[model samples]
Structures are given as C-alpha cells and as structure tokens.
Target: MARTVEDAAGAPHILIVGGGYVGMYTALRLQKKLKRELRRGEVKVTVVDPNSYMTYQPFLPEAAAGNISPRHVVVPLRRVLPKCTVRKARVTELNHDEGWAIVQPLAGPPERIHYDYLVMAAGAVPRLLPIPGLAENGISLKTVGEAIHLRNHVLEQLEIAESTDDAELRRKALTFVFVGGGFAGVEAIAELEDMTRDATKYMRKVTPQDLRFMLVEATDRILPEVGPEMGRWTAEQFRGRGIDVKMKTLLVSAVDGRIELSDGSSFQAGTLVWNAGVKPSPVVRRGDLPVDGKGRVKGTEYLTIEGLVRAFTAGDNAAIPDLTQDGEFCPPNAQHAVRQAKLLGDNIVRSLRGKALKPYVHGNLGTVAGLGLHKGVANPLGIKLKGWPAWFFHRSYHGAMVPTLNRKIRVVADWTLALFLKRETVSLATVEQPRADFELAALDGAGHRNAERPVSENAA
Candidate 1:
C-alpha cells in the first residue's frame, strides 16, 4: 500500500491525476525539484492513474508494426517515481473548492483524496462516432496492449486468408480499412502494411497482390501537421504502393463487416482501425474548473487553471494559451504536452516557495512521422525531409524522448536487433482468450467439443 496524507502526518499533499506524458513528467520533475521537502516529510506527492505505467504514445505505431517491443513503450510508474506515492485508481470527480477528489480504484468503493495542489493531466479519450457496427469492430492504437492486439490481429487475418478456400472470406480477410489520416491512422496503416508485406514472403498462398489497404480521410489531405506539400507527397507514396487513399471521405457505416463509404463504395474488411481524432476527457467538464468550447480545462500561460493558482493542468485536458501564437491555444500533441509539463512542474514549485511563475513560451518545432522502415516525412526547424532522412530523424527524436534510460536502451536495442533478425510475424491471438482451452477441458456435457462461440471481432 502507498502512503497518504495521513501517513505523511498532514504534510502538504500534491495530487496528480492521469499518469500520461503530462502527469508522469510533472511528478518526475517535482520529485527532483522538491527532493529536500520530500525527504524531510514537509510535502507529499501522490499520482493517481488507472494504469500503473505511462505509455510513450509516439512509438505506439511502431509497436503495432513490431518495430519496437510493446513493453519498451511503457514506463512503470512505481519504478520511475519511487520518491512519490503511486495510486492505481481513476480520479472520477474533482472538487477544487474543497481541495478533494473522488477517486475510483480498480476494485472497492470510491475514496476522497484531499490535496493542497491538484494537477489535472488526465489525457484525451477517443472521439468515437455512432456509426453502425463501429463499436463491434473498430480497434484503436492508443496503448501498448492495443498495439500488441493489433499486431496479432493483423497477422491472424493473414492466417485466415491463407487457410480459407471461400473467395469472399479470403477477400474480407485480406482487406484492412483505416479511418482518419492523422499521425495515428497513417503511421498505423503504414507500419502494419509493411509488416504484412514482409510476412507474405514466407507464405506460399498469400502474395502482395492479395492484400487490400485503404485509408479514409474526412479532410482533403492526410498528415496536415507536416504541411500540405509533405501531406500530398505521403498520399502519392501510398497510392504508388497500391493503397487506396480516399480524400474527403467518411465512413458512413460498417455493418456486419461491410463498410459503406460516402464515396458510394462498399466493401468487406476484416480489420477496421479507428484513429478518428480524440476529445478532452469528459471528467474535466464535470468538474467546477472553467473550460473552453471544446471542453478542455482553461489554463493560463503559466500552466495554472484560470483563477486557481494551486490547480495546474496540461496535456490534452488543458487549453493553455500558446505564447508563440497571438490568439491560438496550444495544440494537443506530445511536443506541447511534454514541454508544458516541465514548465508546469516548475510553476508548482515556485508557487510553493513564493517565487514568480514563468510563462511557457515555445515556438513550433515542426513534426516528424515514420511511414515505415526507411520511409518517413519530417519538417524539423523549418527544414523539410522525406524518405530515409525523415525516417532517421523520426527514430532519433522519439528515441531520445521515450522517457527513462531503461526504456530508451530497450527501444534502441529493439531497432538494432531488427536489422539482423527476421521480422517476427507470429500471432498469439489466443492470448486474448486464455480460458478457451481450460474451459473446454472442464466441460463434462455433450456440447464440450462443440460449444457455441461468443460474439467478438475476429480481427482484434
């Protein structure tokens, strides 16, 4: 069990909610800045997150493509923040007026955790639509677990396509549809497609021609973050590789594995990867904190909540004014999330010791995205790069930013070994249902060998 304010004998407690890039980085900096205070028990830091680890989301696409190990993408909270108390729970409600938050643990009843300082770093959730059959079939690439599942699911689809004699079943198995053309969707499809292409070399029945990859973007272009020129180049590259890039398209429905598009095309796809944007956590709206029209907590340039100096917020949940821009808020990305977190930590420390808080002011550093191995696009420091150079830049930037030397070494090691070893394409899909074999053996009735199957996506 972790220590609480009572265990610290009424020390000033700092509560951090949601252990993502913002939450974890803020606590880490605080641990360093307040070392003496923590050692002398003058202050206590408690981080509450539903998960015990922080995921490096930038490498999630690579993890899905098996370019990086799934475990290497996540930093263990307890291991990283030893000086602070780590509570594996979700902060469902916050009462800033009373300095208490209602946290719901994985099990047991909800508990109120009081704090002198609060950090609302709870990141965004997927902005899912009410499209038909989407909830039943869509897969997301947000976490390491989801990345692992997607890798396995894509490989399993190949296996199904190879074994099935039914042409329609094989066609569906080979078809993979990805929604959204942002970083998540584009990189996900690119990596998985590369993996599938490599896996086909070992299979006699399946070939590159048998595969069908489609990318649906509601906007006119893909990867708008990297400029219009690069986005057009990326779309052209995908089209050159025989991928169908449908711009200004919307996924109307996906009922019973059949995809209906706004372009008047219908097809059956075994995989439907949904990377359709994200919205600020709804929990922020439910709280008393002031929010913008988009439901993000309104934060000042100092990274503190509006009118509440003790309350800090960053990442996807906070709409901090971009000092570099005249009237625009900071974009919700890893680049801003990480930089804001460091500044937020310093501001918190300043508030505790009667020092002036510094406003966060950083210009856009440009963007880098990996399409696959030796294939990418980047515009770092206003310099445009494509192909191998961009790919190298992407890896170098993310490799340096993956948090903790332990994870850094592991991620780099994965890349190094990939150059020498054959790509591992085996799918452990059964891991999703570990009880299948045990339950079959335990059954004593006549339907033991022929049990009715539960309804779930075969893709993931």
Candidate 2:
C-alpha cells in the first residue's frame, strides 16, 4: 500500500533523522533548492531530533573557558529552517522495507511516520572506556550543557581550594585530570587552565603553581591533526606552562576519585574530564540496514546507502567511501560532515528529478587548533603556522564557517571585544547546585539553635 500524505495536505514527505551538522544543513539546502516544488505541495521536509538547536562544536572549549557566551554557539533550528517541519523526537527504529520509522516524541507516545525518502544523519556519541567511576564522576565536553558544567566545576574547584584548610582535600580539589589528548581534550585543558591561572590573581589564597593540570594520553604525542613536528612543539609549550604531559600512559582506573595509572602513580582529584573518542550512536544498529564494521551505515560514493534505493546517509554515522583516498572511508569530522551533507542534498534532488547523481570527492584542506589567547597551531593549504599566526588562522577559518549571518557577526564581535577588555574571570559555580550551600548552612544553624533552646528551657 502506498503511504498517503495524511494532514501533510498532499505534499511528498521527506523525513530527516538527526539534527547535527548533516541533517540541519541538508534540510536548509533542500528548502532553498525546492522552494517552488514545496509551494506547489510537491514536497514537505520534516527534521526530527531530540534538540531544537544545532551546536557549533569547535567553540565549545572557548565557551567552557568563558571566552564566549554559551547561547551564541547554538543555532536554533526553527528560526533558521522556517520552511521545514521541525519535530523534537528521536527515531527509535527504522523500517526501510515499509518506508517508515518509529519516532519517540519527547512528550507523548511513539508514532510510525511514513516518508517518501529518508536521510540518516544521527551523529556519534563519546567512546568511553571501562575505567571505574568514569561514567559517574568524569565530565565530558561534547554538548553546551557539558561545557557549562565544566566551567562551573573548574571554578568551583578554585573556590574549594581557596576556602578549605585541609591540605589533602585542597590539593585534590585543585588538581584537574584530562584523559584524552586529542583536539577536544587539548583545547579544553589549555583554555580552562589558562582561565584558572588568570582567575588566581583575584583569589587571595590561591596561587597559580598550587593548581595541578595533568594530561594523560595513551598515545606518544598530542594533536595528531597537526602532524609530528607541531605536535612535539605543542607538548613542549604545555610543559613550559607547568602542565604535566604524560604520554604513553594508560589510565588503569578512576575509582572513587582516585586516579591509578599504569605507571605506578596514583593521585586523588575531584575533577576528571574524558574526551577519549566517539562511536556511532546505537540507533544505527536498531535499523535493518547495511552497516560497516564500526556499525556506521555503509554508503556508496553518491551517499546512497548500499542495497537501499530510497534511503541515504551522511555525517559521522555513515561510512561513506573516501574516493580521494585509494582504499579508505571518510574520517568522522565536522569538515567532512558539512561537505558530505551538501553533496548528499544535491544527489537526493538529482535522484528525485531523474538527473545524474554526483559522487562526493573532496580532499582535506588540512587542520587548525587554538591553544589559548594569541597561541595556536595550524597547517592550512600546506601552510604551517604556530604561535600568534596560527591563533589568527584558527579564529579566521572557523569565523567564516559558522552558520548564519547572525551567529557569524556575534562570534566576530566576541573576538574583537576580547582584545581590548580584560578576560572575564568570574565563574558561576553556584549555578550547578544553587541551593546546596544555603540549605546546608540553614540546617547547621537550626541544629545549633535547637541545642541552645534545650539549655534555655532548663534554666527557665
């Protein structure tokens, strides 16, 4: 039976799953390309995801360090993709044979929605190890909420270090451990470590040297994106700033806030940050679709899923063949995700209109990274840069890539103002548990008063 366009009012429905870079950008491009078709009720694009906004992940480290406002990094879906139907629901299962999917809505029951076409862009999730207490105690920097939590947690550690008289407790609170040395871990630790150092000047009791910043990587070097020479330079730079870079070190366990490394070293810390790696979301496995060894949807050069004509996949969850490389699949990164999404959108339209589909083939443009203010590393267009020049390139490249004019302008304004104004050192630690301190103090005071009332009653 052909699926009827019920309440879609006779429009051909295009159901897109996931709202990450691929899903959002594909929907945006579709609306622009198929505007005339859409007006004639020929098509209706519906994007379903758990989030209403798409987060720009590159700036998360800066946001965590208070370099930029958290709100500015996320682009609201409804405001940008006004022509499409945005649904805040997660696709629980995909029945490719039936040309429909089971969507679990945020507020209500799961509903089976039929579609003329389907695009899977469900991105990856953090790849966590079996390290003890990691899931419960360690914090991740994947989302805006996690970044904000890290910012608050770092500042709260400073406060605890300042007020506490117990030497062991203070040392543990002041020490910060970052588990991964990749881009996310390196950028986060560098920015936050810089922020904490600057904040210590205002904290009378706290000193910069007193705080311990450690980076533990299972690999031999950090920042593999920039290659070997610059990676070595980066490690040296961190060492100069009093950061302990422990390479070729494996994390044995992190049970009960105690970090035990394979090198026979043990340390107690209140904060543990994990940024090891990522894996495709489990939603891919739930679908009866062809997947790669890594559980990513296997796709051909045209971005169409293998053995499925009406279905397509892209972004981190799709194992699209890398035509640029001889025998390799595309790497999971925002750079490739955005480009693949554009190509996927065009291919979809071509397929629908009976035109020849184009293959996705784009060579990587190299990599860039920011290590703090006026400090960075980059290798763009075969040009190697370091220190201030690299930092400039990092900002310039990302500033141009940020979606929408509103977001681009806001981010540029932030960079411009950061030059003249002193860095903001205030940490909203209380934001996490707003009522904890107050409630604890009130309870303690009430107990003291109750104890005095018994003596006063006896005397009376």
Candidate 3:
C-alpha cells in the first residue's frame, strides 16, 4: 500500500516509529548532530506516531489535580523536531525483510513506508486485568484525555455529593477508590484527594470527613521504588489524612459500580480509577526482532537489537541490558528511558558514519513521589526524604525534565498562580453527553409539546 517512490534520493531514509520519550528525543538529537548530512540530502528522517505530541508522564498526576495545565504537559512533536518529517499514524505491521512497514494513517488507506534504518520506541499500553466491569465502568489516568476526564469527573462527583440528601447515595458519590499503589495510582489518588478537599470548602453540605478515599495494593507495601522503610512512612502519611491504605488486598470485582475486595469487603462507588501497570505495545512483535521473555525488544548495551544492525529499540518497549545489575534488564521508568534515548541517538549516528559505537550504561538514581501539595517522599542517592523537602525535590526534578522551555514556563506559572488563587472546582460533565439531553427530550415528546404549544398560541 506504499505510495510509489519516484526517487529514494538521500543519504539514507531513517524512519522512526513511535513518538514517545525515546523516539522524539532521539530524532531531535539526530536532527542537531546530523544537520550537515541532512542538508546534503544524504539522509532524510521521518517520525511516525498516532499522537502528535509526546506526553511528559511524570506530570500527569499534577495535571489531573489541576496543579498544572494539561496543555503544558505535552510537547508537540513537529514543533520540537522541525528537521524531521512527522507522520500522524499508527504502524500496523513491520516487514523488516522487505524494508517496509504498514502504516495506518489518520486519513486515507493504509500505506507502506520504506526505510533504510528503523527505530522502534512505540512504548507501552495499560495492563488491563479481567476484573469485572473494569473495562466499562472504571477510568484510567494515563493519557491527556483520561487525565482531563478524571479531573472533571472528580469535581462532578463532589457536585453530586453536595446536591444529594440520601446518605448512602451521598457516600457512594463521594467515595473514591484507587487500585495500584505504584507512582501512578498513589500520586493520582493523593492529588485528587487534596483537590477535592479544597473544593469541599465551597460546598455548604459537603464536608471533608464525609469523603472517603481508599488505596488498594495487592502487595505488602507501596512505593517499592523508595524501599521498605520509606514505604511504611508513606502509608503512615496517608493514614494521618484519614485515607484508607489496604495492603495485601485484591480487587475481585467492580461490576455495575459495586466493588468487592478479596479481604471480605465490599463498597459501591460511582467512580473507580485504575493505574495498575503497563505492558509493552504489540508493535515490537510485528518485526522479526529479538525479544526477551517479557515480549520487549532485546537490545544490547549499544542500543541495537541483536542480529539487526540497522534496527534500534529503546524506552519502555525495549528490554535493555542492565550493565550495573549483572544479568538483569533495565527497569521501565522515565529515568532509564531518557538515558537510553540519548545513547541510542549517538549510536545511530556512529553507525551511519562508520564510527565506533559506545555502550549505554547508567546506574539507578533513586525515586521521587509527590503526595499532593507540600507532601512527598523520595530516596535520592539512598538518602530518604519526606514532607516538604521531598515535595520540593519532586517538583524541581520533573519541572527540569519536562520537554520544552514553553511547557516548563507554563507549568511554573500554574504553580505560582495556585499559591494565590483557589483551585477551579467546575466540571464539564455535559461533555460526556453533548446531545443526550436533546435526544432524550425528543423521545419523551417534549419537543412535540413545545411545537404544539407554539401553534396553539399562534391560532389564538
């Protein structure tokens, strides 16, 4: 389905699939380092992804809580990687032997794209479980759409709690449940809980005590990245705020707004947020690439896939060798993903110019987590931090890491305004059903009633 190539004129056409952290950054660095080659028509670069922007995932929780503007957390691919051709499409299949891939663009028919070199950094998707009703009733906080949905949904729930007189119904509407104690689940729940508490101040009927927040983790502790001691301290911090932290518990069911836990507990809630974990995207399997047991592309220390010199992989989708950990692979995190991308880009350039390649190696730097405003925990260089200092470190680290200067400035501005202005509590729930009211009214004869009333008035 590829468009006929009138000419394959260039140094070599390099096609990068996926526009996540690794893909976008690799292309950006390539455009800078290989500018001369690009200008000479020696090489042409193209980056393809279903999304036009690369989301700085670390700031997602803040965006969900309205602490940062959602727009500021995403870096537009084309804007930053101007030297590369950005294709807004999803790669359906890769024929490495044929030197082409099947791409399904946003419009038109599927087409084949030819490439001399391929870089796979398609990233991962949310690891969904078979828990009942999760796919239909539960919401996720991974993407921009999901984050905005959660923000508006939380505020809408508070509004519902304020208007209801039935105690049981009010409790159900106010109660929020989060599954998974990892960074995503814990941070999102903590931030949204903080935002909801602040919003309750404007409600005459709703009280902070009336709202219930629950965190469910199947393991013995939370925040594995911070070690056991800090994890225990984090649990204590949440408990101090009246937030229930359930450890060693499993979510058995959540069908029809009813949640049943493995610990012989049950609750009904209008909203459930799931942030369990992620698995590598299926795109890696499309190519005849070496993969590890986890289905991630197996990459050497130099970021090249074994037996595939022209193909490279990195980020969450690549199982890179952990040189520091003996035989283990690098853990999937932004820390490793960013470093891998830089090394991958350098190796790509070296290969193109017939230069020696360098190995990608970096030791773990520790972890950080933000628990709402002025509350956080971190284990930077094995020195555990808690309270306000940890929160400051978390914000500073992520603010510095967020892609462009424009986004960084906007995020900082949002934080500054938050100090003086109250958080916005309005929810646009009608967004979920823009035309539902009119459709329902038409079916109920309200539209006919209005039409007949106008005719009768005119006749009179």
Better of 2 and 3 by TM-score: 3
**What tens digits encode model 3's per-residue C-alpha lDDT throughout 1-460?**
4653332665588888899899998998898889888777778888999999999998888988999988999999999988888989988888777788888888888888888888999999888899998998888887988998999998999998899899888989998999999999989999999999999999999999998999999999998989999999999999999899999998899998898999999989878999888889988888677788878888888888887868988889988888888988888899988888888888889989899999888977889999999999998898889999999999999989888899989999999999999888788878888976655444424334344344435334
Clashes of each: 0, 0, 3
Which scores greater on TM-score, model 1 or model 3?
Answer: 1
**Which residue pairs come into collision in candidate 1?**
none
Q: Model 2, 347: alpha-carbon shift in Å? A: 0.8
lDDT of 1 by residue, 1-460 (tens): 3222344566889999889999999999999999999988899999998899999999999998889989999999999999999999877777899888888888877787888999999999888999999989999888888999999999999999899889999999999999999999999999999999999999988999999999999999999999999999999999998789999999999999899999999989999999999989887865689998888999999999999859999999889898878998998899999999999999999999999999999888899999988999999999999999999999999999999999999999999999999889999999999988666654545645434444232212
- Tens-place lDDT per residue, model 2, 207-313, is 99998999999999999988999999999999999999999998888889999888899989988999988888788887788888888998989999999987889
The TM-score of candidate 2 is: 0.93
| TM-score attained by model 1 | 0.95
Q: Model 3, poorest ten-residue lDDT window? A: 443-452
Q: Sorted by lDDT, highest first, which candidate order results?
A: 1, 3, 2
Off by over 4 Å in 1: 1-10, 448-460
By lDDT, is 1 or 2 better? 1
Candidate with maximal TM-score: 1
TM-score of each: 0.95, 0.93, 0.94
- Residue 138 lDDT, candidate 2, scale 0-100: 90
